[model samples]
Target: MRGSVVCKKIAPVGEVLVKVFPTEIIDSVGEEDAHFFGAIDTATRALRGGGVFSVSDEIEGAALLHYINVAESYRNEGVGSKLLDYSLKSMKSAGTKYVLYRETADNPINLIISYNFATDNGFIPIVENEKILSYKMETILGGKFAMKMMGKKDSLNNIIGIDDPKDNRIIKFNEDNSDVFYKLEKGNYDPCYSGFYVKDDKIVGALRGVLRDKTVILGDVYLETGYESDDIYTSLLEYVLILLTQDVRVENIVIQVTGEKRRSIINSLLGEPDAERNAIELVRYL
Candidate 1:
């Protein structure tokens, strides 16, 4: 019987072969032995009579999936499915949170089937993009406007000016007043990992960054709403650039901005035009 095997976090077999035989050998070995011997011989020839083993490194927080094929002559004997089941169970026992199998993007039939399989198995679809944007400090603007990095304990209510009815909607302070934010600030926001524009004693605008790996991802930029001009946005972005450039190991910076929003301000900035030309479409998973 021919069959296939599926496994996770394990190496696949080294060799697989399909064999044909004459009636004499089939009668001598019986149908079952003939198929088994043919498979073994093929495997031996492929591996020079030595067993082959495949192993892979543990993916930080992900599971690996592999498929192996057995000789077609012994198919439909439950070998393939059994192999798959063993691998999946092993992965689950190893604390793997997610599993994935590959398929051709254009294969609609299999795509539909796999989508259902994943959903039924409690896996969510996530989309990722390979596009990256690189920004350099072409010039220092206005001698790095006087700004003080303050901790959230200084007063969350004070920084946001929540009572100010005039800018309440556009400049929301403590928007994510959740426990998660509090913990994050306490642990990683000692220096505020954020940028702010101060006029007098009040904050006029602010940009926040979330840490991921060694890079900081620029998050929401909140301004006084009516202050949507190019100057304000430029200043906020420049602040982030200054902070990022100070870290020599930081090779890149990332910002998520709509195409329309970026286009509105490109002409107002003085920098390399090539930066704008190389902009790529950013995709995210919901």
Candidate 2:
């Protein structure tokens, strides 16, 4: 009998994640990573053969298939496929945009097994860097999400390029509206060189940055909903760059984007995306 799948909207803790994967895989990823994974929603499927598989819709809108551990007795029973299918369906309903799976270890046996499983199940390689393998989900929500995003092209363009109407001035982030700054930076926020674009004395757009070790790490660069035809980010970035350069220690500026679309836009604005080192990121259309 094939076990039924169960998808949970809440994320699992480190202990639960450990139970889902083998010690070898956990060691490769390190227990520290559990903090990041534990914050997102999870899906788990129980196999009749006493196996279980699990995944999480994590950061960057990618449903990361973290682990699948099936009993040796259940290896060829198609339990994995069933579990993945149900997980994908659940993710689709929840508006998941991507499905990601990564393998960090270089073990040939594990590599071949995981790669073949992903490929045979309609997962395709999106990025491979060194020993890491990243895959994008293709079956359930991939195409659907693509179309949804395509329809929003104009809105996204407006949001990304929105500017203040009253004035084109960039003001320093002060204690007066620090609360507003925190409100806009939803996640993974590090507010260092913070500023905003004002219109009629209201903060309509914001640019956040972090200065560490002589490098300015550009944080969230965003505008409020509905404003259009603004160059707030470009202006704020230029302002911060000039401000940071005044210090003799400042050497470089790096924009740490949360997703591919934002990364592409930021890189295009900044001119010349750095190719010093490559990173492996998995993406799915859904």
Candidate 3:
């Protein structure tokens, strides 16, 4: 599949995108972001293979590498590597840079991309030059969900009484249950301030959090969809808030979630929309 692999630029539109990109990511892009993304010429590599990048006047000689995905069948076929090489060559010449903000996901979907992207955890290097560097960027949410800045009473008031979960025990991930943990959330599995909703020794829902200094950064929640998913999610999230507050080290919390409905739910708890802070940013100087 080496010589067979061909990287071609495709128009960034819903019709062409549906064939190459995930619907969740496609639908998640708001109108403003959609326009920003489509402003450039990208490509449709394979069935589930492609990448999205954007360059702007807002940042000089820098670009955003939105994402690069490949189908399972295309794995190890150099499809991903070719796509990256081609995409970069297609970019704004030497000295230009590219960065990406992807949650270090360990799930199956992300694992495949990681392999294609050559990511150790969530980042990979395109070259061995000094310009190549990848590090974890602590994404901070600024708006209604900034628990650290919010008063203790204010934060607690919003989380309480979300939904009554029958029996939820905070789970610390370990060697045995690490596999289950990945299924629940999309990011890397960390034991600190994270847990799952266990029923009969099986994980039904889960939430992941990282305690960084005085601020606790939250990750995505993974729950098997069923009856009252919203209720269960609310309950799990609310319960975690209670547990974190007990730790004297926790003075603030940074939560990252997707979907407008979920955002609205968090906004309801935190008050009104404020502003979103820096989340994931990657830098690569060419």
Top-scoring candidate (lDDT): 3
Model 2 C-alpha lDDT per residue in residues 1-286, reported as the tens digit of each score: 3434333332435566555556665664455543122111123343222122233412444456655545565457675676566566666676666677755443556666777777787787664432211112221123233343333333232222213222323333223334332343223233335555666656666666655566666654566566423355555554554444445665556554444554444444443433222233333445
Q: Per-residue lDDT tens digits of candidate 3, residues 104-126?
A: 44244643444445453234442
Candidate 3 clashes between residue pairs 3 or more apart in a chain or in different chains: 10-42, 10-43, 99-282, 139-279, 148-252, 184-222
Worst 10 residues of 3 by lDDT: 128-137
Off by over 4 Å in 2: 1-20, 23-60, 132-282
lDDT of 1 by residue, 147-262 (tens): 22223133222232222324433223334322221222322331334665555555556666655556565643556656665566666665565566566655444554444555
Clashing pairs in 2: 97-286, 142-286, 162-230, 163-230
The parts of candidate 3 lying over 4 Å away from their true place are 1-83, 86-192, 277-286
Residue 279, model 3: Cα distance from true site in angstroms? 7.0
- What's the distance in Å from true for residue 281, model 1? 11
Question: What is each predicted model's overall lDDT from 0 to 1?
Answer: 0.39, 0.46, 0.50
**Native-referenced Cα lDDT, model 1:** 0.39
Which pairs clash in model 1? 1-74, 1-75, 2-74, 2-75, 4-80, 6-84
Put the candidates in lDDT order, highest first: 3, 2, 1
For model 2, how many clashes? 4
